[model samples]
Target: MRFKIIFPTGYQVADILNDNIDINVVLENGDVFFGTLFTISNLDYLLAISQEPFFYASDLLIVKDLSKKNIRAAIESLVSGSIELAFTKIRSTWSNESGSDSFDTIIDMC
Candidate 1:
C-alpha cells in the first residue's frame, strides 16, 4: 500500500517568508520605518530595535488577506498596550495557514 504525504499550507507560507520582502512600520514617535521582512516561520515578523533612521525590526504575524488599515491598526494597538486585543482581531481573520507566533519578544530585551 502506498501512502500520500500531505503537508500543511503553513509550511509553504513559512518557506516563502524565508526570503527578503519589503514592509513598513509606523513608530510610536510618529516616525515610519522601512525594511525587509523575513522569517523561518510565519510566527514572528522580526522588527528593528535600532535608533538609526534606516534600521527596521519587528516580529509581526503574517495575517492573511488583511487590509492595510487593519494591519496598521493591529500594530498601533500594540503601542497602546493592547497586545491581546490586537492579536485577537488579527487571529479572527487568520485561517492558520501561516505558522507565525502571535506573542512578541520585545519584552525579552528589557
Candidate 2:
C-alpha cells in the first residue's frame, strides 16, 4: 500500500510508504548518516540508529519513500548526494497504481 506524506510547506505526495524507508541526515559539517526507517508519526520518522537513542529519524526532510526492492538503491544514491537519482529510483518502486500517472511515467521511462 502507499502512504501520503504531508510536508510543512503543504506539499503532499501519495508515494510515501509506511514501511521501511531510508533517510539522510546532513549535519553542520556536511557529514551525512544513512538511517533505516522505523516509523513516521506526524511529520517525523523514527530511524534505526546504533547509538544511545538506539534509533532516530527526527528533523528529517522526508526526502524519499522507498520499497523493499529499491531501498538499498535509494540509500546508495542518497549517500552520494544524488537526490534526484534517489527519488527517481524510489518513485519507480513505490508509486501507487491509482494515483497520478506523471510520476509513474517518469519512473517507467527512466
Candidate 3:
C-alpha cells in the first residue's frame, strides 16, 4: 500500500528530513513514518530507534476528508501527551493507495 501525507498549513518539515528518502515507509504491520516508502516482507530483521516522531500507519486511516483547521488542531494536540489522539484527530489528512514501493519521490511545497 502507498500513502500520502498532507502537512498542516504554515507547517514545514525541515530540510534535513528531505534527504532521508529511506524513511518514508509504511509496514504491513501498520507502522507509519515519513521519508520514502519501502516494503519489507520480514520483520525479524528490522530494528529501529529514533527520538523523532513515530506512529501506527493505521492511525492515518481517515473518517472523512480533512480541512486546514483539522490539521492545525492535530498539530496542537501533539503536545498534549497523547500521540494516538493527535493522529486520530488528523486521520482525515492522510490517505493511502495500492502501489509498489520501489521509487523515491518527494514533493516539498516550501
TM-score against truth, every candidate: 0.26, 0.25, 0.23
Model 3 Cα lDDT, one tens digit per residue, 5-63: 33333343233212111222222234444322112211111223434454334433221
> Which residue pairs of candidate 2 clash?
47-57, 49-55
lDDT of the candidates, in the order given:
0.32, 0.35, 0.30
Best by TM-score: 1
| Positional deviation of residue 41's Cα in model 1 after best superposition, in angstroms | 13
Candidate 1, 10-89: lDDT as tens digits: 11222443433334333322232333334434323322433454533453444432333433443454546644432222
Rank ordering of all candidates by TM-score, starting from the highest: 1, 2, 3
Q: Which ten residues in a row have the lowest lDDT in candidate 1?
A: 1-10
Better of 2 and 3 by TM-score: 2
Query: Residue 25: error of model 1 in Å?
Result: 1.8
* Rank by lDDT (best first): 2, 1, 3
The segments of candidate 3 whose C-alpha lies over 4 angstroms from its true place after superposition are: 1-65, 84-110
Error of 1 at 90 (Å): 24
lDDT of 2 by residue, 21-79 (tens): 44433322223343444325423333333335544344333334544334444444554
Off by over 4 Å in 1: 1-21, 28-58, 82-110
Query: For model 1, what is the alpha-carbon lDDT of residue 108?
Result: 15
Evaluate candidate 3 by giving its C-alpha RMSD to the native, one decimal. 16.5
